[model samples]
Target: MKISCSISFEQGLGERLMFFKRRIEKKTYDKSSKKPVIKSSICNGEQVAGFKDIATGAFEEIMLIKNQDDLVEFKEIYGISEEIEKIY
Candidate 1:
């Protein structure tokens, strides 16, 4: 499943892409001087919602969890935390 989220800032797309590039272990690319692309597939009902950052560009990715265990494991593996912030 591919989830689309709005990009809510006016900044360099490369900087925005770098933010997520450091966070998620995924492939990112720049196409024809357009916004950077973070490509991933949704399996087991998990999806990347969108991302969030204002200065460098920010958005969020949402995922659907079918099992509580999986959610917990994801949080642990991803090290999700309120204090954790992504920067370009």
Candidate 2:
């Protein structure tokens, strides 16, 4: 499954890759750069609908932040254009 999500970089690059499991796991960050590095991976057979924080550079999963208040805030800040398509 490949899910496409619109991520706001704010001050980072675009089209960066990241990994995904049933939920996101650790061990994906670059020590030298001190930023989250994708290393060209998408685990759990699903494209994650999320984004990285420009300041922290951490990849965030949409499913993890599904709270009503947070979702509304995030949608207002980042918009709700990102979509995840399940693979059959």
Q: Candidate 1 regions off by >4 Å?
A: 1-51, 54-58, 81-88
lDDT of 1 by residue, 1-88 (tens): 9999876445676433323423344333232332321224554333332334334554445444455544444454444433333222
Predictions in order: lDDT: 0.40, 0.40
Q: Which stretches of candidate 2 lie over 4 Å from their true place?
A: 1-45, 64-88
On residues 1-45, what C-alpha lDDT tens digit does candidate 2 reach at each position? 999987543545554444442432322323344322122234643
Candidate 1's TM-score: 0.24
- At residue 35, give the lDDT of candidate 2: 26
